[model samples]
Target: MMLYLAQTTGEPTGGLAGWAIDVIDALGGLGIALLTVLDSVLFGALPIDVLLPLIGYTASQGAINIGVAIVCAAAGVVVGSLVQYTLGARLGRDRARALLVKLPGIKPESVDRAEAWFARHSTKAVLFGRMLPVVRPLISIPAGVERMALPKFVVLTAIGSLIWNGMLLGSGYLLGENWHQVVDIMGYVPYALLGALAVGVPLFLRRRNRRRKNAATAIVETNTSG
Candidate 1:
C-alpha cells in the first residue's frame, strides 16, 4: 500500500497524484467532502493495514486536500459506525448471545465485560474506540446491542473519528514526501503490540493455572490433616 502510494505520487508516475489533485480541485468543496466521507467510512471500517498509509500518502501529496478530507472521512466513519450499531441493536442481546455461543474462542464472559464497560462508559468507550485499530469496529457492535442514545453516539463518534482521521492526514501532510515512510514505520506499532500480547497471554495463563493448582493442593492437604 505504501509503495503504491509512493509510486503513484513519485515524479515518474506523478501523473496519478496530479490526476487526483485535479479531480479534488474540480470537485471544489462538495466533491472533496464526498470523497473524504467515502474514504473515511469504508477504509476506517476495514483493517488499518492497507487504508491508513494510503490515506496518509494521498493526503500528504495534497491529492485529497486536508480540510475537505477530514470532514468527509469523519462523516464516513460516523455513518459506518451507526450502521454497525443499528444492526447490533436490532439483533438485541439474546441474538448476540446465541451467536457468541456458536463462535469458537469467544468467551461469553468477555462479551459481558464489554457490555458492562459500555453500560458504565458508553460515550467514552465509543469515542475512544474509534481511534483504536480493531476495537473501533467491535465497540460499535455492543453499543448497538445496548441501544445507546442516537444523538450522543453520533456526536461522540463524529468527534473522535474526525480527530483520529485528522491526525493521520495531518501527519502525512506535515511529513510531505516522506509521509509514506512515517506511516510505514508507525504501522509496525500495532503489529508489535499484537505480538507482545500473543507471547504474554500464554505466560499469563500458565501462571494463573499454577496458582489455581497450588490453592487446590493446599485445600486438600488441610482437609486430610484435619
Candidate 2:
C-alpha cells in the first residue's frame, strides 16, 4: 500500500493542502491515520471532510484502496477520541474543560454545548454526535466525564465514524477527479442553510399567526350567532 501511494504522484499543490498531500503520498495509510487523529482532536483545524475526499480521489486514481483508507480513518478517529475520553474520565468535567480551553482554537462555550448535547441525547449522543459539526470531537469528552461504558462508546463511535467517513470517501470515489467540486460546493452550504432559515422562519411565523387570527375570528362569529 505504501508503494502504491508513492507511485501515485501529482503536480505539487501549494500550501498546507499540498503539505498534506505530500505526507499522505509519502506515508500512505499511516499519514491518513495520523491526520485523522489530529482531525478528531483539533476541532476543525485539519478539515477531514476535504482530506477524506482527496483520499477517495487518490483511490479513484488507483493509488490506495478506498476500503483501507476508510478503515485507517476510522481507526484514527477511535484513537483520538479515546485520548479525549481518557482525559475526561481522569480529569473529570471541570478540569477537562479547563485543559481543553487552553488548547489552540478550542472555545469554552463549545465545550458547554457538547455537554448539553450529551445531557439531552445520553448514550446515543456518541452515535449521532459523530455526524454533527463542532460536536463531533467534543462529544467524547462528556461521555468520558460521565464514565459511559467503554464498549458502548467504542461501538457507537466506530459505527458513526464509518458512516460519515464512508459517505465522504464514496463521494470522492464517485466524483473522480472533480472531487474538489464537492469542497467548493460545501463552502456555500452554511450560507445556503442560513438563507433558507432567514426566509422560511418569517414565512412560517406569518402563516401561523394568520391561522390563529382566523381561528379567533371564527370563534367570535360563532359566539355572536349563538
Candidate 3:
C-alpha cells in the first residue's frame, strides 16, 4: 500500500521515508489530498504518518499550501468513508454468510453473534466500531446485510469516520514534518500495552498471594491463642 501511494504520487518505490517526501514534492496540495481520500475510502487504508510528512515537506518546498492540504485531506477522508459505507449497505449479510462458509474456522454462530451485537447496539456499534481496525470494516458488512435504515447508518458512519480521520489528519497538519514519528509511535502502542498487561498480571498475583499468606498466619495465631 505504501508503495502504491508512492507510485501514485510519482515517487520511486525505494525506501518509504524518502519516497513519502518525494511523493509530496511531486503531487502538491490537491494531488496529496486526492491520494489520501482514494486510499482511505476505496482501499480502506491510509499511510497517515507518511502522507503528513510529505505534506510538511511540500510546504517547506513551497510546492503546496498547508490550508489547501488540510482541506484536501479532509475531503478525501469523507469520500473514502462514503465508499466504505455504500459497500456495506450494498453487500448486506447474506453475501457475508456465503463467504464465511468458505473460510476456515469461521462459524455460523460467530456471524449470528455479530448480527446480534449490531441489533443490540446498532448506533453505538456503528459509530465506535469505525475506530477499531478490523472491526471498522466488518461493522459495515452487518449494517448493510441487515438492511439498516440508510439515513441512520450514514449519520453514524459519517460521525465516527469524521472523528477518527480528523484526529489523525489534524495531527498530521499540526505535527508537520515530524508527523511520521507519531505513526511510528502508534505502531508500537499495541505492543506496549500488551507488555504492560503481561508484567502487571504477575505482580498482581504475587500481591494477592502475600495477602492470603498473612491472613492464614493471623487465623493460626488467633486459634492457637484461644
Instruction: Name the best candidate (by TM-score).
Output: 2
Judging by lDDT, tell me the better candidate of 1 and 3. Answer: 1
| Candidate 2 Cα lDDT to native | 0.80
Q: What TM-score quantifies how close candidate 3 is to the native fold?
A: 0.52
Stretches off by above 4 angstroms in model 3 are: 1-33, 40-71, 97-120, 185-226
Error of 2 at 168 (Å): 0.9
Q: What is the C-alpha lDDT of each candidate?
A: 0.62, 0.80, 0.59
Count of backbone collisions within predicted model 1: 3
Q: Write the per-residue lDDT of candidate 3 for residues 1-226, one digit (tens) a residue.
A: 3344445656445664454445555666556666666655433344554556545544544555655666665566556656655665666567656765465544566556656757766876777655554445356567776677778876786677666555555555566555556566545644654466568758987999999999999999999999
TM-scores of all candidate predictions against the true structure: 0.58, 0.74, 0.52
lDDT-wise, the better of 2 and 3 is 2
**TM-score of candidate 1 relative to the true fold:** 0.58
1-226 in candidate 2: lDDT tens per residue?
Answer: 3233323534235665666767788888888888888877776577678778878888888888899999998898988999888889999998998998998878998899899989977776788677667788799999999999999999999998898788787788789867767666555644664466568768987999999999999999999999
How many pairs of residues collide in each model? Answer: 3, 0, 5
The pairs that clash in candidate 1 are 36-72, 36-73, 37-72
The weakest ten consecutive residues by lDDT in model 3 span 40-49
